[model samples]
Target: MTQEDPEIQILLDQAEELYSSLLRGETTLADATCSEILIKLETAIEKKKHELKQTSKTSQLC
Candidate 1:
């Protein structure tokens, strides 16, 4: 199986922790809904993946 990118993995881990905190009623960002957090995380992961792909292509061209 392919390994996950470290940066993306970190983001996922952080998101999970935040979600867990929300479930436990310990989160300070009360205004942010779980779905909103998830959407932001997903967007960040996609951006990171795109950056990695661009970097790889640039390196290959060198």
Candidate 2:
């Protein structure tokens, strides 16, 4: 597997923690931050994957 970008890793870790907390009933509706974090994490992962894919294509063309 490809190594994860540091920023992506951090976001993933944070999102995971938040999700787990929600699952355990530790977070309330007042704590709506997890949804935001999940959205950010999804966007970041997609951006990183797209960047890597483009880089790979460029390398292949060279």
Candidate 3:
């Protein structure tokens, strides 16, 4: 498996922290707001992963 890029890792870390806070009831975010934030973060993470994979493939072919 390929290593996660640092930029992606930072995003993942932020997502994890947000999730943890939500689980602990530390935030006042509404349910809909939380869902939207999570969805956006997930989408970003997926896009970053795809880009990393594509970059790695291109590098291998160089």
Q: What TM-score does model 1 achieve against the real structure?
A: 0.53
Best lDDT among the predictions, by candidate number = 2
Ranking by lDDT: 2, 1, 3
lDDT of 3 at 10: 62
lDDT of each: 0.70, 0.77, 0.69
Clashing pairs in 3: none
**Per-residue alpha-carbon lDDT of model 1 for 1-62, expressed as tens digits?**
01456655666677788878877888766544545556767887778778889999999999
Task: Flag the better candidate by TM-score, 2 or 3.
Answer: 2
TM-score on alpha carbons, each prediction: 0.53, 0.70, 0.52
Regions of candidate 2 where Cα sits further than 4 Å from its true position: 1-4, 28-34
Candidate 2 clash pair list: none
Q: C-alpha displacement of 59 in model 3, angstroms?
A: 0.1
| Clash count of each predicted structure | 0, 0, 0
Residue 26 in candidate 3 has what lDDT? 81
- Model 3 scores a C-alpha lDDT of 0.69
